[model samples]
Target: MSFSPTGQAQVLVWAPEAEQVELILNEGNTSVPLKKEEFGYWSVTTDLVSPGDAYKFRLNDDQEFPDPVSLFQPNGVHGASQAYDETSFNWEDDNWQCPLLEDFVLYELHTGTFTPEGTFAGIEQKLDHLLELGVTAIEIMPVAQFPGDRNWGYDGVFPFAVQDSYGGPEGLQRMVSACHQKGMAVVLDIVYNHLGPEGNYLGAYGPYFTNKYNTPWGPAINFDDAWCDGVRRYFSENLLMWFRDFHVDAVRLDAVHAIKDFSPVHILREMKQQVNQLMETTGRTHYMIVELDLNDTCFINPLEEQGYGMDAQWVDEFHHALRVTMTGDQTGYYSDFTGISDLGKAYKDAYVYDGQFSPHRQKSFGVKAEGNPGKQFIVFTQNHDQVGNRMLGERLTELVSYEMQKLAAGAVILSPFLPMLWMGEEYAEPNRFQYFVSHTDPELAEAVRQGRKAEFGMFHAQGEAPDPMAEETFLQSKLQWDLLPLEPHQTLFRYYQTLLKLRKELPALKHLDRQNLEVVENDAHKTLQLRRWHDEEQVLCLMNFSNAPQTVALPLNAKTWNLVLDSAAPEWKGPQPSAPTANAGTEVLMQPESLLVFRGQS
Candidate 1:
């Protein structure tokens, strides 16, 4: 869809099955016929409609529906689509360049709950908060048009339209420009596996979905089915639109594991090729980070290596292993992990389950990510899925002690891989990030509630899950920004700030070099030692996950180790009066559920 400044609008719709289509403008006041072109395409140009004018397409002159590729559904999803002039918004990021992928410290957030206003402008108001927290990048959950104002964003029906309640397309453009001006990149999460069941009219246009494969949500996207070219082109263009139009630095593809395609060149590889071409043509750096459960290196391997050339992938195994060690609640997928040993494996190798048989999966899972670099894996402790999918949507601090919360932070940040923090994690917000939605259909709402109940049957925990259809559930998920000045929350915030500073300034921590990293795990004491070096600078991380204090041997080298930042220090509210330092061949005692960082030099 394109709009002209002089009250002229033109649209190209792909409705293969329809014999005739009409363009309706001004709430059904004006109607114009569209000419049919090859490949089941329809086009019309008219001066009757202007920018921001509402429009819809009538199929077979029978029933009207919003454009399949609507750019802005100013009205709700059930309402008419609006003509948006993409060139109207002036972007001030012409001189801005995204930071390198390896140097990213991402903070994941939802636009609706990030601020009280629950809009794109709301997020822009809190830019200083993120900057003070030392976040180099902010990954926003999907803004695509969904059934209602509240959603996890996976239920988006329109891939191109920005949610109207969240300030529409112009509001998003402003936020991206604001972030670029603040020297921060934005990562937008998008779901391409399946469109939401409600307000989805893609089937009326063409074979956008196929029954050959099924995802957890429903039928898979028609990537490998008949007449799949249009379907593939539809999503590929959507990917390009975000980068070219909105200036998104990166896109976090949600659940790539659910997308089943049997084509020779997988859809991911194909999208990567297009993205590479776009980057080369525009001379800008952009990244594609995937949320994948299958620990396959083929997704992140170099294109020359006959693999998909994605920039990075979210390593859920790392979070699972880390959580199991901290909480020890072996339910659901947590049963497959063995606490500190798996965390050690995650440190050495990107994936904990590298071709190993799992009791949870009951089959061998994940190939070895041997040649992959540390930057290819994104590790996080409390993401939306990890928190909201729980029975009560409990944050890490809610389930563990204050020290264990600090330990979880250190585990992700001090690791060699890229680190991400969920929304409200830095200041230890007490609110639960529960699943909430406002579907207009009552039966659909009830179905979602039951689905959430069935999804958590394996946990066998007490109490019923919160109702997804409740307005209170959505209200309960909002971040309590006032907690920043509280007792333990302020201390935890400073601890994260110090760790982030060290990550940026320290030589050994700054560079991501997996080849020069070593991990030593002691199961008897539930401790792990990590040593990383770059050039002549070295850093050691000692982590104790046990309930009792334990002693860890330092590196037997000539370099003297100086204590940098210790979670067990009194400054961080630990029981210890002061942090301890050690020399080579000496041992240092680590407090229970604490982490210690040492900077070594000869």
Candidate 2:
């Protein structure tokens, strides 16, 4: 909806199924009939509705519902939609240039749990903390308006409206502007797979869903079926709205595998083309990162190469292999990973299961991402799913020792791939990041509780899963910022800061070229030696996942390897006081469950 200078607004609705459409303004105090146009669209130029006016659409004299393209749901999902002027907010980030994808050190966070306030403004208050941690980008979880204030955001029913509880549209603009001023990029997570069950009135408008494919949630979106053109336009406009109106640097599409689109011109490819056009038109940098379960390179590959042209993708294989090697937990997907050797493959070839027969799926999975650069893959030890989906939502800090936690940090940060840190992972916060929701429907809430129980059947969790509908569950998942200045947590925070600093200062680590990388895994000793070079600057990352000290022979070279950072050093509160350097043909003693970084020049 766009308002004219004379307070007249132009309203448009796409309701192919409705015989009559009425614009109900201010709780039906004023109503204006819409004229039907071709292609199942209804439009009207009305003076009754203006900016900030609460409105709803009445279909064929039926029950009134919030706008399908509502910009603001002030009273929640089941309430009236408020008119919001996207051009009203004064942006202060005219000169903000987003960092290159290769340089992005992402910090994934949930808006409601990152702070006590649980709003976008609350996030703005912590910009200095993130800056001190050396995070280049902040990937916020879904902020689309869900049923209630406590959801993890996957249950969002209004795709266009910003969460009213999270300070609404203006609040997000403030957060983005603040981040840009601090030289940080923002990546917003979006869901195009399925909308939340409650308050979902799209079915009354048109065939927005189809039975062609079934997603884990429910019926897939109608992206390739009849009347898919309108459905496609709705989402494509949403993709551009983030960059154009909200000033978001990028969007992390949640579960692209679940988006069932079989069109000849794939929806993903169309999105990429539109993004490119927007970037060209606005002269601003933008990217589209996808969360993909399938380890397919077609999504990240270039358009010229018959690919979806996505900027990057999250690689769960790296996290799976790393977790298996460190924790030795062979439960669901971890059974497919073989330990440090698979992690070695992840370091060399982004995908560990490249056309290999999987015991999990009982079939060959994943194709080789051979020529793809290391920057194309995003690697992390813990994410929202890896942590929150657990029955108890145990973070790495809860399951592993202090040394192992540091080792995990080193494993991700010291690798060539883009590194992302989950909220509170830096300080090793003890609170569990469990799943929670606040659905109004009692039956729906009960269904969620039972669903969580069924989902955890694969893993042998000792006790019953926490009640996802409980308010305490959401409160318990929040990050404890007070722990930052406390013991062990502060040390770990410094350790991560130092590692990020080294990554920026060292050429061998800063350059993300994987072609010059060589990874050697010793399965018997449970160790990995990674050697990568940029020009004359060479670096070696030695990891020991075993529980016993191992004396590993160093490769004979012309240059001496000097100790850079050691997880087992006394400074990091480890068993060892310091790390030993290795010369040509010499040996170094690696502490149990520790990682060491060394720099050398020839």
Candidate 3:
């Protein structure tokens, strides 16, 4: 089962349906016969295939196709898989260690549109910028191979291979190396819930999928059925490969709620246990974070609590509450969150629907996370799904005023939880993060377009759905790198950088325990305030969601209070207030669509 380290060729192909299978090298220039086993898996071994050598699978009657689990396909999705030498690349991050979860200032970006070049190498050049902006980690959207060169990466079929268009496997390794050198950890967003519609050859190979459960995409993966042990191992091995081979520090599991596993030990727990063992063996503190819409804390709880034991989980409640409070848009899911009370609850409890009614789901769900530390929750104002799934891909910057945008930023960064920022959110880039996919099948493409449009019909009735297949939509989604150098963008970027710096430097803000946090709400005035105090250091944060200025007395007593940050400063083009009055002890004025942070002297 093991090949020599000097670059030998060994392949394991599970093709029970195929009558015959052979290795076709370089478009049928040569062929190597494979040995079939009782389990219906074919095995091949030869020194003929070396790194960069193109090859394919030849089934019965010379029907040749790419390897189902190809490690590298330099030529493209339809091309032959090249022999990939994972150990050839010289890595210089032997001493690199990732920052702790509490120290993470995460920046989420899509690889296909994060820069002008939209390649792995292109992103390497911007690592210094992120490092300078105080980002401790970069969470890249899925890089697994999809149907075409351009995609958002979520519709990936080849979970083990990097996208050939985005510089392939070698390009990705280089990007990770460069990031480690800059003291920034890399978190890869991986989709295990479902594979893309096109090039999904796993079903042809084995029972990689099942009809026992249905996901939004289609039939769910067979993680608990017969031969499902190997299926789960496939994904677990993929996670290990990323951390050991590519030096990725963490993995962000996309849409975990869709992973319907009925096994005694769930796939999430198995993956977590394997990752923990890997971390121990490698002496690296890697993380496994999940994106779940379930609003459940079990994923982030300890294994002793009969939970999945994830390091952190994304809290959609935080984003939903902030979105409704800032924009006041009550269509779709926003209908469940209309008042400032929801925002206040999200700020204090980190889950607005803690066993409460959810009009969108037509069910009462979620459990209260009272004693859990805030570091276990990853809070964001905007993320890929929140923006890209919209009809026009309008980000928070497009709907909320500049002051509210800053307030949103402060609300997340200064809170007791870890914060994540979507790409271009710091500078309020005007570009939209629209959904894009590249499907080879004509019928599949048309179906996708129709389904997308139909889904948005209830929310937005006008205009045709932006073609997910169009090259222009993909190009338009790329980050406008030039905007960072412009006026207002530059100013806002500086503000975000300052906020990150403050979060790192200030002891009061760095405290992430939920027990140390307290919140007060004035729904009538559309105002919410959160007070985080620990060890004699106190921070009072106030946010005004109304369209007009309002004044509210501070809920805490302090001898001296200094104005720290104001979202309504002239820099953000909002009303500026005079210097904070001295000895304001229990009274402070708040501006419309603004956020204020005050540090109190004990």
Candidate 4:
């Protein structure tokens, strides 16, 4: 795993079943027999190898493959694994620190499609723009090494290696260095549930995968299986490597519900404990967020309370509610939600389906999320999953009118929970964020295409599902950055900038408390209002979801309310200004698909 001062490399490979293993180096011309050790590990110390040297293991003098925990795969996963000295990169973030979780306005973006360059350097080019947009953190999708130059990054096979196409390890470090310069935190998305089909050689190393449990990808990882101590160590070290070496402020674990581990202490809890230790050692604040569909509060709950102790979880019920209320399409899992009331519940509480009967799942789902802090629940209207998983990969802009789109932005930005805006949503990019993949293995590529197409049948979507392997699919999904400065896009972009400005400057908005936030819904007219307060300051966010103007009875506790911002104002090219001018217990009219922010005194 490391090298000695004499330029000798201590190469170790876990091959339990192999009787003989050889370390092959120098273009396969040199082979050194490794001494077998206790509990199935082969090791050898050779003075010939150094950092940046390409090497692989020969199992039983026949099978040869890259190292399972390779630090850098310069020649792709199928090629020899290269030794990388992580200390070689010069990082400039010595005094840098991440902002408080409550102060974070997250922006989730795919590194590849975020810019035309499709590299870490490309994303670094846009950091200033993100800082100006009031983004505290940029959550980059998985940049782990996958098969080819282009991928969504979920198919990453090498946990340690940064995508060779995305400017490798140094490139990622530079990107992080750039983010730190602007006081922005960097969060990386990592998949641990299952490995991708291509370039997955972990099974050759040890009992890394088990047939006892099955994942959507294939055999589940051997978390609780026989000879699983090594398996757990392998992945846990990967997590630490990111935090320690890559300087990642946070890690967004993808699909923890799919990770099946039956043990006294779950692997996620163990990872969380180790991360806390790392944070204490480094004297830095680190966050662990999860993308969970189970809707179980156990993921973010403290370890003493028998929880995984993750910092936050994505609550997509708000997105579902907003989508259903705006588009009125209740297909698939959207069947559980029914318009503004559901949206109101998600706003007041964290989740709409908290212990409620789900028609989509045909059972009661989710635990109560009320007691958790609002920041613990990350809410978003549009993200990679919500948009890219679609049959046609249409964004919210394609689903609703321009007015409703602004309302969607208002709902997310004004919500008590931590909110994340997907890439290009600020300027209303028109490109479809479709599911795309580039697998070198032709069979795997076709299989992915087939699986993605088959999934759309559950939703009963019309037209043919786009081919996920097609290069055109990925190219078409890239953001239309040029459109941001154009007509309506520029206006919407400014509207978002203004909303974020209010969120930062307003005390009531900034000092968010989830428990006491209130929601008033006028279901008859499809109008919803939220009353949130902190100390002596209070704010009201009112909106009409319907296509017709509605007169809503205001529940203003103060003598008078002043309109803070209006989506229906002519300044933003709306039909008319839907300004609420009334005292406590009076009524006010709201334009169709309009959201109005009001400030009032206690």
Best by lDDT: 2
lDDT of candidate 1 over 194-283, digit per residue (tens): 999899989988899999998888889999988888788899999999999899999999989898888999999999999999999999
Structure candidate 1, residue pairs in collision: none
Cα lDDT tens digits, model 4, 20-129, are 99988898999989999987888988887888889888888898989887888878879998887676678899999889998889999998899999989999988888
> Model 2 Cα displacement at 127 (Å)?
0.9
Worst 10 residues of 3 by lDDT: 578-587
lDDT, candidate 3, 343-427, per-residue tens: 7787788888989888889999899888678888899999999999888888888888777788889988988899999999999
- Per-model TM-score, in order, reads 0.98, 0.98, 0.96, 0.97
Which model, 2 or 4, shows the larger TM-score? 2
The true-versus-predicted C-alpha distance at residue 373 of model 2, in Å, is: 1.1
Poorest 10 consecutive residues by lDDT, candidate 4: 453-462
* lDDT of the candidates, in the order given: 0.90, 0.92, 0.84, 0.87
Return the lDDT, model 2, position 357.
96
On lDDT, the stronger of 1 and 4 is 1
Ordering by TM-score: 2, 1, 4, 3
How many clashes show up per model? 0, 0, 0, 0
